[model samples]
Target: MIDTNQFLAQMQEVLEIEDRTLSPDEKFRELPEWSSLAYLSTIAMIDDEYNVIISAADFRELQTLGDIVRAISERQP
Candidate 1:
């Protein structure tokens, strides 16, 4: 099972977000570090860590960090 806390930590590390306010409820796009590179980083992180294949277009459609958690969660066996 994918832990949400681990997800947040990986996001922080990948996105370089030092803010402790990082949470699933937060908007992924509102982050100051958010960019095309960050989007690709996130895709790579999820693919590597969760073994879930997510595309750049799908990441663009995501609104919140929780959406990512849900996406991977649903894919979990």
Candidate 2:
């Protein structure tokens, strides 16, 4: 199983967010990661890391990072 901590840390690194008001449980839209560029970065990260291809619109439907991870797993063959 992929480590959630490492995944979240990578997410933080990709988004350039910290643990302050930003959290894994928090909505991406609620944080500075809501930007279009951030979405592109996230899509790249997910695709490169998990072999999953999803769009920012797909991510908008999620509730949290947990949901995003689940989506990535679901797309796995």
Candidate 3:
């Protein structure tokens, strides 16, 4: 099972965000550091950590960190 707190921390590392903590309701795209590279890094991080492959299009549809967690949970066996 994936813990939300741990996942948030990992996302912080993957996104190279050093100054602030991520929240479940936070709109990641609104972050100042958000960019194409960050998007790709997020996809890679999800794949490596959860074994779930989320496409760029699908990823774009996700609005918040909690949305991502729910997507992964629904896709898991």
Which candidate achieves the best lDDT against the true structure? 3
What tens digits encode model 1's per-residue C-alpha lDDT throughout 11-74?
9999886757588899988878988888878888888888898665765677998899988887
Worst 10 residues of 2 by lDDT: 17-26
lDDT tens per residue, model 3, 1-77: 56899889988998888888899999988988788888878888888889998766777799999999988887775
Total clashes for model 3: 0
Ranked by TM-score, the better of candidates 2 and 3 is 3
- TM-score-superior candidate, 1 or 3: 3
lDDT of 2 by residue, 1-77 (tens): 45667778778878887755345586777775577788788888888888888775776699888778778777876
In terms of lDDT, which candidate is stronger, 1 or 2?
1
Give the TM-scores of the predictions, in the order they appear. Answer: 0.85, 0.79, 0.89
Winning candidate number (TM-score): 3
Q: List the residue pairs that clash in candidate 3.
A: none
Worst-scoring 10-residue span by lDDT in model 3: 51-60
The regions of model 3 sitting more than 4 angstroms off are: none
lDDT of each: 0.83, 0.76, 0.86
